[model samples]
Target: MPAYSDAPLPVGLDALVGMGMNRVKLAIAVALAEHGGCLSTPELIAALGEGVAGTTIARNLNELEDHGYVTGDVPRDERRRRRTHWTLNHANLHADLRALIQATTPSGEPPTVTG
Candidate 1:
């Protein structure tokens, strides 16, 4: 059988996944993008379901935040244990991110590559 593209993800995304962009991180970003680009930790946990632990999500969120891929917003009056809303960094990556997200979806097809 001829070799076929499995998911049709763009080259950049493939490279990103190869470069240690774990599934949870990608899922978080995709979830945020799909849901108005912002969500609290609890909302994310709910969206991601129970397979992933809450602590794991929190740690990955921090890692994403540290990498400038996402940001956590804490309200001034919020309590210590309250949730911090995470917002995907769109200032410099909105279009690129949307394109990547679209390309990685189930129905997304990769563009023909020519050299």
Candidate 2:
């Protein structure tokens, strides 16, 4: 399990800048958000459907954690050798996205890209 910063943000915004808003990272974020925060690598792969390798899932999880969008905890099962569990940091996700958009847009101007 990995650790992440304690923060609040939306999943979409986090995925956007956290992983450069790439498709795979966005998918991972959606999976966690849809599941209400908390999913193992295998679970994410399963949710993403087949063809997603373990390494790919691992990479995405790590990336999310690095960006403070997700946090990991020890597995409840003691029998499980590898401690693996993750929770979404909604605060960070929302904050990051807001910051990203604000930083990119001019002051007092409507977001041209959105409308």
lDDT of 2: 0.72
Per-residue lDDT over 1-115 for candidate 1, one digit per residue giving the tens place of the 0 to 100 score:
9996567666545434321468888888889999999999999999999999988888887777655677789743462698789998855344444556666566656544222
Q: Which pairs clash in the backbone of model 1?
A: none
- Model 1 earns a TM-score of 0.60
On TM-score, the candidate that comes out on top is: 2
RMSD of each: 9.5, 7.9
Backbone clash numbers for all candidates listed: 0, 13
- Model 1 CA lDDT for position 7: 71
lDDT of each: 0.72, 0.72
lDDT of 1: 0.72
